[model samples]
Target: MRTTRSYLALALAFVLVLTGQSMALARTAPGPDGQIVLCTGTGPVAVLVDDQGQPIGPSHICPDCALSLFQALAETAPEIAAPTSWLRAHPIEFTLVFHSPAPRPAVARGPPQAA
Candidate 1:
């Protein structure tokens, strides 16, 4: 009877661990809106949301581009960029929002001289 109880306890513990991990994964998963927001900077920072109004994640930016963005933000808003000292420090939050699709840029026509 004691051995059975011990086995059951071990099983329960394993199940609990698995449940916790799954919950964490779910939180990180993209929602129906497919968006995630991260808070960036010290305070009162602004983040651009996508067409769906979802806050874009850092992964969307390439490493080199991200660095450039950080530098630019630092110059414009030192307080916001201060948290970027850490390699993984992301000071932006992505919020899902609704946006009308943007129209494509118009193509330029031939020069007047050619007409």
Candidate 2:
């Protein structure tokens, strides 16, 4: 009986948490021309933006996209972006090396004597 109640409580809590998150994401701010800004993007590859179209923190975008965004934002000096074409040109190569200590000579022993 206790187990059943505990499981029910856990499930209810899970549902409540999901509902709260969805509600938070569904929040929209009034946009220009009386339009409401809606959360956009599919799956985890999402970006939450403010009414001004500026991105908000704690977005759901992918890790790679977040990395690129941060790298672009941190650029202080004027420099060309790193080329990624070389990655496809060169194939990944893995090398494995094994090393073992010199083997010791086996010594012949007679039957064990009673201690």
Candidate 3:
């Protein structure tokens, strides 16, 4: 019981951390045509921007990034504004996987002695 509760607490903490990290950045990101404002690795990137639609930091295009919401929605489907042909070139794909806890091994005990 304790282990399960601890695991849940740990999971909650992790979720909060991730949520906070994502919220730290502005909700807005450059549109599909929008360029990269600033990025660290080839994966996740945060394109900085001022009130105006202008790059406040170093902005560039991420070639490694398979796809972004703007691109996917713009090209694949008509969710946001008009569709874009550019997203066609740079396709984006997102995958989700589910994980399950491993079963605990059965404990062994010696035969009970006669009372």
Q: What is the C-alpha lDDT of each candidate?
A: 0.64, 0.63, 0.63
Q: Provide the lDDT at 98 for model 3.
A: 91
lDDT of 3 by residue, 1-115 (tens): 9999999999999998986665544344343334454555776676655556666665434434535646766645545776555544767898999999899999999888984
Best by lDDT: 1
Q: Write the per-residue lDDT of candidate 2 for residues 1-115, one digit (tens) a residue.
A: 9999999999999999986676555454232332334555743444455667666645344423445776678758558888866644677899999999999999999887985
TM-scores for all candidates: the values are: 0.28, 0.26, 0.25
**Candidate 1 lDDT over residue span 19-73, tens digit each:** 6676666566553444444566865555555668867543332323445776676
Off by over 4 Å in 1: 34-115
- Model 1: residue 7 alpha-carbon error in angstroms: 0.2
- Clashes in model 2: which pairs? none
Candidate 1 lDDT (Cα, whole model)? 0.64
- Distance from true location, Cα of 91 in model 2, Å: 96
Question: Positional deviation of 97 in candidate 2, in angstroms?
Answer: 99
Clashes (candidate 2) = 0
Worst 10 residues of 3 by lDDT: 24-33
